[model samples]
Target: MNLFHFSDEGSIDVFLPRVKENRKELPPVVWAIDEEHEFTFFFPRSCPRIVYTRSDEMSDEDRRAFFGATQANIVVTVETGWYERIKRSTVYRYRMPAETFELFDTIAGYYISPRTIVPLAVEPYGNLIDRLIARGVEVRFTPNLHPLREAILNSTLTDFGIHKFDNAARA
Candidate 1:
């Protein structure tokens, strides 16, 4: 089973709805927003998967609640459409090598899963890809555009994998 990690949150929303409308078959795909400084997991059940304000910025009780809510094995994080408009037009032309890899490694360690799919905008370089392969990380290449349909249709988790979070983990 493959873990599909999308670097772009905007595309995820687009793809998810499309999948529902078209009734496409897919594998178990988990999404994590690869942002500049943090890896945010989106929970379909929760209202907000991530807070723009840091934990330190929140009160002790709120911090505890935030961490408490994050205990879910999977989550849904949806970014605002307004921010996506700005990001796509001006801020997306340039790519940072180190920051992108950091995001990948962070998600790998946190999720502790073998497979992950990230957007082409922040895809790892050739050398980093080699390192990931060496470490037994199966990184799948996904398209950068409106690839929601293709991604969901071709996901490994949906095809051959199962989501064991509720039954096994909750037990």
Candidate 2:
């Protein structure tokens, strides 16, 4: 399986194992995403986003409530304040050696490694909105993520991810 790491930096010689401030409880590790869920990182590093997908086990009622009439299997929501940044930002996609990583969160397509990692290659990615749309992903822009956060948590959206919420706008 192909694994990747996304960054805003144009050039990266190597990726070192490190603990994020929010993840200090865990050991330092390199993070990578599998090809299937790379869409999760198609934004600036600190851009808060909520991503949800239609699961195979989803009930029609839950699907209708969460997905509405949209045919998109995946929905990604970001605050409106980040819209301009999302458009102007250029993120680099770094291919990683799958052998050095192990599955971390299967649902999120996340992988972790205790050892340092060197990217196999790096490629610049732009047109974030178009890329997401081309992949049949519905991208949403909201003023605040607070309400949506609570709704998703209480709803049947099991296949969902709330990212960098601490950086999200306050309600």
Model 2 residue runs over 4 Å out of place are none
Instruction: Report the poorest 10 consecutive residues by lDDT, candidate 1.
Output: 162-171
Candidate 1 local distance difference test against the native: 0.27
lDDT per residue, candidate 1, 2-109, as tens digits?
122433233322222122222246333233333332222211222112222222334556445323444332222223322233223211111222222222244233
Q: Give candidate 1 regions above 4 Å deviation.
A: 1-35, 38-54, 69-171
Evaluate model 1: give its TM-score. 0.19
